[model samples]
Target: MIDQYSFLRPWLFCLDPEKAHNLTLSNLDRAERWGLLQRFITKPIADPHTLCGIQFPNPVGLAAGLDKDGKHIDSLAALGFGFLEIGTVTPRAQPGNPKPRMFRLPEAEGIINRMGFNNDGVDACVARVRKSKFWQSGGVLGLNIGKNASTPIEQASQDYVFAMAAVYEIASYITVNISSPNTQHLRSLQSEEMLRSLLHDLSEERKKLSDRYGVHKPLFLKIAPDLDQEDIHLIAELLVEFGIDAVIATNTTISRETVKGMEYGEEAGGLSGAPVRAASSQVIKTLKARLGNALPIIGVGGILSGADAREKVMAGASLIQLYSGLIYRGPELVNECANALRR
Candidate 1:
């Protein structure tokens, strides 16, 4: 069956990456509705790991960016991911960057994207998750929320708070995304002062929501891969100081070192794939070393195989996520990686 689908790759690859993505997602939605996806795909491995007080069946998770609006939770969960993170959703829905924004670096096993936090807004995303049969089946879902692109840096906290309030009731865990490079000055929020203030405000709001909803979901920080030692240390300190639950080390990186000579190498956006493996792992190692197990780390970036997943675990990641890898490898990649983790 996998071999038969291999023939479709050329046709699928012919389309622009963004269009192909939408078509694929739409097909999966239809498959679920027809009750065919579940019968064909292998069942997800149930390794049963715990993180942020939630029990995940396996350590391997589908990273954010693939399902921006939680629209295909059932389809994704059916593909054997241990957990699924949906969105870099903002307070309001907005069209992302212009066309040709998502580019594939097949030669480098990488992808360059300036997706710019595109999604159908927090309320819509929350509503879909609320209606998801997958969620009703007790699947673990993490909401990755970010500020709108036009929102000022100083006022970014308000956007985060708004998203949090909207999705707080439905999310098993919430990830605060402040590292995407496509948005102007978004990464600046990672600086010491900005990070401190942003996290402090969000932390206060998280507590309020927790009490109000009578549920204490873990609030994590999703960081970027393009940070220096000082930047990493400061962010680690902030995570500890602010009582943030976990840190998702290393979102897509702006550095094009991995895809330096590729066709889209010069594109202005974050690069994600095999090239980011070492950089992201280093961040995880640094964070774990700094936090000393005080906080759990969710490692993501450049994970293409089980070996990559194992390396992340050895480096101190309690959980692992993949985006580009899935695009290049297909659904079997998830089962293969999870099976490798068990060994």
Candidate 2:
């Protein structure tokens, strides 16, 4: 059962990370279909917060990457996340990097993954989102988009623009993810010139989509945790200049100082979980200082407890999200965070 994930943890941990993830979602799907998930999934207490013109029932969200293809929306929503985000879905489907791309560092309570935007593509993901009960449940849903791995850095906007067009009508908001380190040259999009062009193109496209759908869906930019003063300042400037809707700070860290010698510590992928907590909060702090009220931030990265979630909000995050924490703590972290924020 979902809440009884502790009982299944040992068995799930025995399999490969990706395989375990697939099994978990598959079982969740089966449970939801049988109407048995509600027994295991707790109802998150209500604590409304609105950002990007959308009101969330609560602030704690299930971050993107867990349901890359939007396949388990209704089932995953049973966990009581205030909102749910799906995909890093691209214009085309592609098998990501080779096997063993995801590694669990249990000792460090972190995970390293280079799963390069491997989704069922924008079309399938959109169709699935349109079909999910969560989509029509009036719950906040964000569709995170990214360029395909094979897409060149020079023409990355094409993939983002295409994916945005496909999901625009249905998503409560769209997240432009240019921060994942797994894709080659993907983070290069965060550079000033490229970042400007990417935001500019998406902004322009949003206008047309708004007119076509008669409603505008907000566009949030997801950034990486490894940033400096210059990087943060320029990104804040570009976001404001382009009128981006919101920002999801600190995707995952390429920095490994926190887990250097631990098993699977040297793996070549972005690191997340307890290891990235401080780095993510600091990014939120910096962005809050620069953006002020001009933009709102959704803080994510390494939130494993209520205090960690509270620290993010105290640091100026408009809201927070979880990925690795959910993997390590199970569904209870969702309610723990919701209650913490309510207090």
Best candidate, TM-score: 2
Compute the lDDT of residue 116 as modeled in candidate 2.
Answer: 89
After superposition, the stretches of candidate 2 with alpha carbons farther than 4 Å from their true spots are 1-3
Clashes of each: 1, 0
- In order, candidate lDDTs are 0.88, 0.91
For model 2, how does the per-residue alpha-carbon lDDT over 25-50 read when each residue is reduced to its tens digit?
A: 99889999998878767788788998
Q: Can you give the lDDT of residue 173 in candidate 2?
A: 92
Q: Worst 10-residue stretch by lDDT in candidate 1?
A: 1-10
What is residue 19's positional error in candidate 2, in angstroms?
A: 0.7
How many clashes does the backbone of model 1 have?
1
Report the C-alpha displacement of residue 56, candidate 1, in angstroms: 0.7
lDDT of 1 by residue, 1-343 (tens): 2554467667888999999999988998898888887888776558999877899999889898899998899988888889999998999989988877998888888888998988899989988998898898888999999999888988999999999889898998999999999998999999988888988898899889989989888999999988998899989888989899999988999887677777888888889988899999999999888989798999999998889988898899998998888777777778878888898
For residue 223, model 1's alpha carbon misses the true position, in angstroms, by: 0.6
Clashes of 2: 0
TM-score of candidate 2 against the unseen true structure: 0.98
